[model samples]
Target: MFNTVLVANRGEIAVRVIRSLRALGIRSVAVYSDADADARHVREADTAVRLGPAEAAKSYLSIPAIVAAAKETGAQAVHPGYGFLAENTAFARACAEAGLVFIGPPPEAIDKMGDKIRAKATVSAAGVPVVPGASDVDIPEGGFAEAAAKVGYPLLLKPSAGGGGKGMRLVHQESELDAAVESARREAKSSFGDDTLLMERFVTTPRHIEIQVLADTHGTVLHLGERECSLQRRHQKIIEEAPSVLLDEATRAKMGAAAAEAARSVGYVGAGTVEFIMSAHNPDEFFFMEMNTRLQVEHPVTEMVTGLDLVSWQVRVAAGEPLGLTQEDVRLDGHAVEARVYAEDPARGFIPTGGTVLAVHEPSGDGVRVDSWMSVGAVVGSNYDPMLAKVIAHGPDRASALQKLDRALADTALLGLGTNIDFLRGLLADEDVRAGKLDTELVDRRLSELISSEVPAGFFVAAAMDRLISLQPTGTVVDPWDIPSGWRLSGPGGITFRLRTGENQAVVRVEGTPSDASVQVDDAEPVRVSARREGDLLEVRRANGVERYRCADGPQRTVWLAREGKSFAFADQEFTLSSRGEAAGAGPVKSPMPGTVLVVKAAEGDVVSAGTPLLVVEAMKMEHTVTAPIDGVVTELSVRVGQQVALDETLAVVSAAEEKQ
Candidate 1:
């Protein structure tokens, strides 16, 4: 076994690899960028190296820097823990040349399967069922239309060298093909550095299912069943589960056999994934999509259900050890489900959010596992992916696992910035989601219903009230150790607390004495709260639940409250509360959540009708244009381009117009 290994990735996966290395008695070396000096993964490594700046293109993707770090640390092997340069064929080959094993498939396999078009051709030739698509070489503007003629309308134009829905588009009309091609090519070039894309006959409603395959240096390959990743948005997976509710015993046997054959055809080694699109409407007809040459983000669900550690196995295989487990030995124990928690807001068009994580408390239970890299007061930079953590749960059956997952998601609490937390919770309760009638287009098809539905305002008010009570000077919230509070009366039973999001302002009514206050937003119900030190960490809860409602900071107070992934913070609004009924409530257009103030669509003098986009706020990797609430004359516009905003912060002001008779 290798004495030491270098992890060539960051965040939760880095921590995951280190844990595995420690269990195997191997020293782990972690590499970090300037933004990651204090990152949890770096802190946990046995030894660490500084790579470069926070920009991934300059730091994480720097192969020479990583190789040098490995040499400096005397690591016998390098583990590309997915993402970054995980599938970079050059990186694998260079590692080999440097006398260090790469803990994944060989460089040859990467090169062969890295290109989607070629991989499909190779696998199809090996008797695997591949989707009917035009090769990248034959994907000219004119050729695309021709291919669609043969392949049929509703064809998919996908980048030959990308994943996660980037640089891909589905065309339903021939007139839209030209523009879609140009746009997809542009995005593909920016993301993958290769503009090559292929065409495929698009399945109307297909389940995004893929089989995990493992290969050994000893010529043995095995498939580890399928994972359902059908529920997605823009090709990015939101919900994933193993032991798919759709597959049957006979279908599993055939898909597994085909997956194994595909691996063998390419002389595959180590771990890889064979992606397929199953027509849920017609399960008998499935087609190959692409192959991932590294560990996928959804690997945890597979891990829990299969009772295996893919990372550990990768290391063992790279060390020239054969895969000890055979197909028959691969037993599917139960069901597993996962939800990715991201630092992006759903209402604001899901744009990536940037802020310091003020507080974080992960969910814990019998079958729940949270893979994360954040603690308290971690600065979230715009240079990286905003995914904060992954929450997974496993059980003997799908229903039990789902119930566990719902509790797990509801239990996770965070403060600092807006997230899609509430959105994910809504997905769990969605009728279609609960029934397993998911497909690649499901997120798009039901985008409105999912985003607009959730717990009532009482929850937000309750959460806000919880934050208020935890902030008292005498009865203050403390870390871990026990601490008491002194009761003191101040100016008013309620004090004025103000929070600014862009140009919008949220005037909240916090009803209580100086010691404790009940938060009432608009006309929402209030929740009880108390905060004091118990042992090592400060604990606060909304009412009396296992979950903790809290905030943490570096120097300044950074606060966060989780609403699914769309948690909100009101640090700028920390003032004494007063009766809201007396103060003249200002007509403020507050930011609905934390996001980027993208565009000020309306000017100060412009009179607009209801539904007119006053300005656009982009959040959680999506774009949303905030519109006018009613027909009114714009009195004052208070925001600009490229501004960071919090929930319920004002955007602009408008005077209501007289009714048209």
Candidate 2:
């Protein structure tokens, strides 16, 4: 085994790799950008090196800087954890040129499998069934319609040079072909530096199943079964599980054999994944999607089920070790499920969120494992991926695993920012999901039902109680005059707190002190409530029952609360404005998240209808288009391309059009 390995990534993946290195007694070196100087991975590694600025192009994605860091740290090998340059063929060759081992597939294999167009041909030649599709070269000039007619409707446009759902579009008919192509090409160029695309038949009700494969220098390859990654949003996977319930033993063996063959055909070594798309209606049929040339984000689920440390094996193979076990020796012990916890808000179209983490509570105990890089006071920014951590659970059966995963998510809490913990719990509790009736579109289909926009009454009550406690005199000073007990010399006093979250607003009225108070939310019946704070937790007692909330005070008088996996950020109206000046006659178009304005679609005085795209804001490699909310002319345009904007910053305004008599 190598004595020192350099981890060329950031966030949870870097922390995860460092953990494996520590377990194997290998010294780990971590590289970080300016934004990640205080990242948990940097603190955990044996040695840390600064690559460059926060911009990924000059830091994490900079091949020269990473290679130099590895050489300076005297690292014997470089482990490209998942994203950034993990699948880049040039990085692999650079390692070889520098006489440092790359703990992944060879450059030739990466090059062959990196391009989706060529990967389909290579895998097909090895007898692995592939989806019927057309490439850019396959289509004649201005012949997209002809190609679509031949391939059939509902086709998928995938960037040949990238994966991870980036630069992918689903076209249901010829009418949507041109726009889809334009968007896909633009995103593809921005993400992968290549706009070349391939079209494939969009399988109805498809289930994403991938087989994990490991290969050695001695040409021995083995499959580690499959993971079901059908639970997704915006084409990105949020939930994954190993030992898919959809596959029987016979089908599992067949898929595993096909996956091994695919790896062997590309001369693949180290850890890789062969992704397949299977139709929910036809379980026996499967089509090859593409092969990831490095360790996957969901590798923990596979590890838990197979009882193998994939990273350790990757290092052993990179050190020129032969296979230590045969295919028959592998046995999946139990089922495992993993839910990705991201710094995003599912209520607002899953837009990325950023803030300082004020508090965190990761679950523990039997059957629960949390691979996280989040810590209190960690500043989460929009400079990179929004994923904060992953919560995985293992059990003897799928039902128990799902149950444990739901319970674990309920116990998890991260205050001071928005997250998808509640959304994940809701997804796991879906009747169809619990029954294993899963498909890629299941989340999208039930998104509205899963997301609750109504703020629970308890949240408002807790916020009021928290404020009431804070208003009381502290430091052993007991002054009856200073007490905010809603007490008066003549009669009882009352305090009112107006709180707002997004479009929802609530007026909380409190009478008396924290121990004995009558709380009423937005004209609702006053209920007896009392609350006490213990560290970050706030215990509130109400007429119904006692509820505990993980609470934290944020900047600008924002109260963050988490209970039962759900989180809320309530802004005290006394300290902040009730609205962002949206009550005026003009409809303001605001940036959904903090990001750079990539494209300005409309200008001042331009008439646009409702839902017209006005600007596109790019953050964390994802683009969200701001559109006109009403049929009117663009009265004001406040931003231009390449300008950095904060969340909810007004980008433009549309004055309502005059009504004709």
Candidate 3:
């Protein structure tokens, strides 16, 4: 066992690895970038070191800096936690050259599986059925069209050197082949520094299933069943589960054997996973997608369902250990589901959200666990992936696990950032998702309908009422402006507040004393509310739910607290009232979420009809287009190409057009 292990990553995964190391009596060291100075992972480690700036290239991805940190901290081993330099063959070899153990497979395994084209060839050579595609490694640009045609029109162009849906494109017809290739090449270059691509048959309505394999240096390898990663958005997984609900005993056995074969063929050691694209209609039939030579991001689900800690096994295997349990000894119990909570918005193209975390109150209950790397004041930086946390729930069966997940999400409270908590709560109750009849493209098709699903109106009403009840200065007595001598005013006297947080805003009016208040969001309706200030706490109710807020001597701030599942936020000076006192919200057009604009779909003086795409914004690994509100000329364009914009900053303004014939 290593006396000290250095983690070469950041965020939740690093924290997760550290916890497992502590369990095995190993000291842990953490390295951080400028943006991650205050991150939870840094604070949790036994020792820490600086890596550099917020950009990954200058910090986490810097091989020399990480090696130096490990050596300086007296770390005997380096654990690349799933990303960054985890599968970089050069990094693994360099660690060994520096006389530090790399707690994963040998560099040979990494080199074999690092390239998608080579991985497919190797797995197929090992008798595993890989997806049929071109054998060419680097086909010329002009030759790409011919190869894609040979593979059939509806095919996929994927990067040659890695996975994660990066640099991947689908073309349905021959006419679209060249364009998809160009885009794929650009994306490949930007993401992995490699523009080489290969064509493959596109899997339709596929379910991503992976087998977790653990091997030791003593020539022992074992499989831990399968995980269903079918629920995805833009090729990124949102939800993953173990012991795939659709897999029968026979199919499970076959896939497990195949996964084991792949591992043994490569002489794989430590924790690894073999990913496959299974058909939704027939889960038994699957094709080899790729093999990951390091710990996977979605490994926690398998851990929860299998009653095993993969990280512990990885450490044990790397230390010249043997597999204690045989394949027959492995048993998977109750169903487990993991929902990846991200600092993103589902309503507007799932763009990344970066802001100060004002407050957090996570839910605690049976069969629920949360893995996060955020604190109340931590900033969601642009230096890494925007995942907030991974919430996992285990139950006796699928239905029970799902129900527990819903309850857990309901109790989660994270304030001061735009997250998908509310969106997740609604998804758990969705009929198609509950029935398990979904595919990779499900979210894309059902996104609008899912966001439009009604959130508990009471939660919103209570939040508004709480703001009205708690926004008073200290040592101020009520009823000072009464007309009669020391008289109390008759009827309810309310004050309206315009509260805006990015693209979403609220207009709230509250009146009367803290004991009894009337709250209204708009003139259309008025809600009778009761507020009570007990000591330093204030609780108000205008509807079915009650909101509690703590008052402090500071500028006007709205503290948004949600139960565990719903994403919430709080703001102080950034949320300012408009000139006319209306909320600082805009019209039908929406701006990017702190992202760089790639293309302006509509230009100034360009006459456009309603619903025309106005601009295209790329942020946080996804692309979204803003559209025209009504038929009108693109007037007063304030933004140009290659410009960055905040969440609600007006990118453009449109003039209402004359009626069309």
Pick by TM-score: which candidate is best? Answer: 2
lDDT of 2 by residue, 276-298 (tens): 99999999999999999999999
lDDT of 1 by residue, 467-535 (tens): 455554354564522211222365344544555332234556666632354565555455555444332
Candidate 3 positional error at 222, Å: 0.5
lDDT of each: 0.77, 0.92, 0.77
TM-score of each: 0.81, 0.97, 0.88
Clashing pairs in 2: none
Encode model 3's per-residue lDDT on 163-281: one tens digit a residue: 67766777899897776776677667756678888888878888888999999998888999999888887677888887787788999999999999988877899999999887798
Model 1: weakest 10-residue lDDT segment is 479-488
Q: Model 1, which residues run further than 4 Å from truth?
A: 140-142, 453-548, 551-559, 563-566, 571-661
Q: How large is the C-alpha RMSD of every model relative to the true structure?
A: 6.7, 2.1, 4.6
